[model samples]
Target: MVKSADGVIVSGVKDVDDFFEHERTFLLEYHNRVKDASAKSDRMTRSHKSAADDYNRIGSSLYALGTQDSTDICKFFLKVSELFDKTRKIEARVSADEDLKLSDLLKYYLRESQAAKVRLGCEELMMGILVCILKQCRAVWLGSQRLVDWGRRNEDLLYRRSRSLVDYENANKALDKARAKNKDVLQAETSQQLCCQKFEKISESAKQELIDFKTRRVAAFRKNLVELAELELKHAKTGFLCVAPAILELTQ
Candidate 1:
């Protein structure tokens, strides 16, 4: 994908140049921006945009609090950004692959994303992220092995390489380097190396409270769907349909 008319991809970075390193410039720029953005709580989010955005902000805030040193916070945030970016790219690649169901990819990314946040969030968020990630990791590990086998069986055209594949490669290289320095150093668990604490399963009370609020929100959810259905059905009905004002509130 990085070939120009002269069979050369133009380098985006100006400072230094490496011909063989196609992804180096883009990766460096991405890392630098995320590193800077993640460090400042001021720029985290003045206004929460979406659920993912909210988690990202909270993750950054937690990074600031959980560590004693500035270097620790910066490193943790960079690790999470790497995970998040890789997860996004993997989701896109899996979606575009004709051999894979997009649902599986989305589910994998969702769990990975949440897991990254958990390694970086609070008690409740961490527990949720851990549980989901544990399950997803097992499935993904198996799936990737099978995918490789399938690729060999099918002439290697089924699925594109996942973005996490690159992250995994980088992580393995780091592990190898560390191992070379000190043979006694055990490589940490791939999933929980950065996870500070083991999150216990959440309490029933918290689950119930969240569920009750969501159940109430569904009353509003149905109103929008029902309104559209009614509009279609009542095109022939001339009389005024009397709907209660309390129900009208749900429409909005």
Candidate 2:
């Protein structure tokens, strides 16, 4: 564990630890699922090329978001197609993720996608939703920073607090003063305990926020499901209608 100057314990992580181990798992899993879905579409002899391209774009955006690299984010999300492909399955699963226990925010987001009411074209919904979510998160992050600052200030107060130990030449006087000093010491100890408890509560609150985020994400996903379903349905109908032409051409 790494302790900050003020004794805040920051846990140790592994080398590949992008501080997103939990998130990475979810991303990789989702990526795999999307790839699987695309592969299935390929089996249907749909426009695999377009889907594959969208898949790459989604990966690129995921990489950028994970690294906080706008360039990568731009590559993935700049195109409407890429955005939709990436976001589609995710929103579909958002409700599930919210209800699950997660060690990382990314994982939480990933799990939420599972609870999606409509299992449909996740690709189309990825961009618009994320663009909005990111903007909202920026505002919330700013607010959190202020709260963190307040916590730090409260800790700072502890560092400057002084203890006074007075000694009287007379034994009786010394005993009396010691009793009073002991009370002061007890007060300090109580304050420290209170701070510890407050810190713990704050940590728990952060955890709850993550859970709540996953939950709220489901609502957004519900709104997006219709479009996803339409896309999937369109793809299915298009493929069905096109099969006869391809079969006839192949028979030649």
Task: Report the Cα RMSD per candidate.
Answer: 27.0, 18.5
Stretches off by above 4 angstroms in model 2 are 1-8, 12-47, 50-184, 220-226, 243-252
Per residue, candidate 2 scores C-alpha lDDT tens digits across 1-252 of 212321221112121223224533554566566456534533433334445455566656665564554574444334433344444433333322222211122222333333121111111111111211232256654543443443343223221110000001122344445567775555555555555455445434433543454455555345445544665566556555555554564455
Q: After superposition, how far is residue 106 of candidate 1 from its true place, in Å?
A: 20
**Whole-model Cα lDDT of every candidate shown, in order:** 0.34, 0.37
Model 1 whole-model lDDT (C-alpha atoms)? 0.34
Question: Model 1: clashing residue pairs?
Answer: none
* Candidate 1 lDDT by residue in tens digits, 117-212: 222121122222211213235665565445334323221110011112223444556666777787434653342332212111112222343344
Which regions in candidate 1 have their CA more than 4 angstroms from the true location? 1-169, 181-192, 195-222, 239-252
Error of 1 at 227 (Å): 1.4
